[model samples]
Target: MSGERARILVVDDEKVIRDSCTRILTTEGHIIKSAENGNIGLEVFREFHPDLVLVDLKMPGKSGMDVLEEIESIDPNVVQIVITGYATVSSAVDAMKRGAYDFIPKPFTPEEILLIVGRGLEKRRLLLESEALKVEHERIRRNMISLVSHELRAPLAATVQYLEVILGGMAGEIPSEAKEMIVRCDIRLQEMLELLRKWLNLATFDSPKMAEHFQDISLSDIATESIELMKSLAEEKKISLILETSKDLPPIKGSKVSLEEIFNNLISNAIKYNKAGGWVKVILYGREEEVWVEISDNGSGIDEEHLSRIFDEFYRVDGRRNAPIKGSGLGLSIVKKMVDAHGGMIDVESKFGEGTTFRIGFPKFFQRQKEG
Candidate 1:
């Protein structure tokens, strides 16, 4: 029905029915995979990952219902259609409730089968598109929050500092315990202010103007400075910070500020998430035409599932786990965006309870620089 040709899986105990359905679908320019039993159908499902599954209701070993359950468990997005000669009203309704896209009665015409399969494929496409849009909308919303948070930081910092000055007797003397309470207020205010600043920086990078300001910058200098600046914070946590860089590395065309921000956020995160007496090692090297910078920390590693989504704005796994680490969760997101803006890529390798490593690559030459 759509411009996209679909892959279809036809599973039935009867070879004649299976071949007939496969032949019809194949003639319609659809890629078809066939299985004569429910067990083999599940294996084919995993391997083919078809756009639509046509399951016979009553197969040996595993019924269509059982196979449908397994498919739903593996990937809920797959559109399934129940094919049955025993298509009583109850059976049809039961199949629909069990996540079948539609129920097809057996001894059906080729036209009937084709119509059902086409509609199922269309539904699958719509579902996938909807899911993609949902993710995009969520990402945009998070980016907006990150941007607004950043914009709020400067004013917040000024307000907090002025309040601190007033409480510190710069303007007038305050009561003793009142001063203690004000001090606590100032601490919380400062923490909020820091979070706001991080959000603001994250937001700024999202802007086209800020994203465009990238050029060739020395990786070694950036790495060294970032590590040095974070040394104190790591020391406070009793974490050892180490830097290992290849001497005279090739310069990458990227925003110095963005690179600085990237490294600063990464190192800060490493220190923030690390256990006491842990170690953070930053290594910089060049391979062929690309420069690589990797930051590794002996902190609590993120789960494999989370590593893929950690770059999403405000995605905080630790916070979800009720860990004490304080952050706005925009750091990794910003890092990813900035690196992408610079025509680069970033990856994470981590193991739970051991540690995490964030590796980012930069191209030696940026297309934007050549254009300019």
Candidate 2:
């Protein structure tokens, strides 16, 4: 009553009761409609589209309990209230379970109905307002990501291209010291560009769009390819790279690029963090309903305090041990998002001074297709 006026529907068998409720509610500046039976009530509900409904428990033809259930199926957010002569605990509970907001007894006062209706309308308003806010927030987030990515990347990329031209001696020859400084600057700027790209990838990960590109892909092939890509980096550290796969493994439906990113990041990290003569092993196989891949390393393992926050965005482990290791800290976060998007699971195991292992499991392609 204190907020915006609402369209209200009252469904009952007795004409007197309908007229009484219609008269009482109409005076409070609320639009009202009434039906003499449950079946007629459903018809009026579809056309009138009231924000709140008042349904009588005992009715001819379709019962009020059935009406409550059908309304819930159509639109669960629509507020529902029950009207009954016998307001027994069991009946009230049944109506509530069927999605009734509240119930008023046969001999109730106008004030009682008005109070219940007002509460229901307020709840409806809040639900609508919350949904609107969520849409607006998502819009702002998307716009911000676009702005940052374009504003920083366009100029930096152009600068890098010009530097490449100079380094190629296209313009003229230069002193060795000057050329070295230019190379150093180029390296740092390239690092910045890579970091910016990773940040955008994590921020703009749209699962629905990614799902459109999904195809049946083999985890064994993905793992083998990722190992080949990481071999150069591992060789520099004298870290041995090994991949083992089970034959006749089942495939999974996923975006190839996202799955590649997951494996690349995990394998790269394993090699970068390992000591000389250490090893990184990738094992791929299939289990019931899922294809599992594990990457393990004999590297400096994560401490207990740092493990919890490793998957968080821009969260780098702090201390002297990790000081020399440079990273954007967005890799694991991106990996986690891509895994979840593909209907997969990822887990990590580590002991402080021993080693670390990462396991990823994806639902099999045939099973996913069946579920869909």
Looking at model 2, the pairs that clash are none
lDDT of 1 by residue, 61-129 (tens): 889888888888888889999998887989888888888889999899999988888788888989999
Which pairs of residues collide in model 1? 150-199, 150-200, 214-255, 215-254, 216-253
Tens digit per residue, CA lDDT, model 2, 120-213: 8888887778878999999998888878787888789899999999999998997999999999999989988988889889888888777877
Instruction: Give TM per candidate.
Output: 0.57, 0.83
The clash count for each model shown is 5, 0
Best by TM-score: 2
Which ten-residue region of model 2 has the weakest summed lDDT? 363-372
TM-score of 2: 0.83
Question: In angstroms, how far off is 122's CA in candidate 1?
Answer: 17
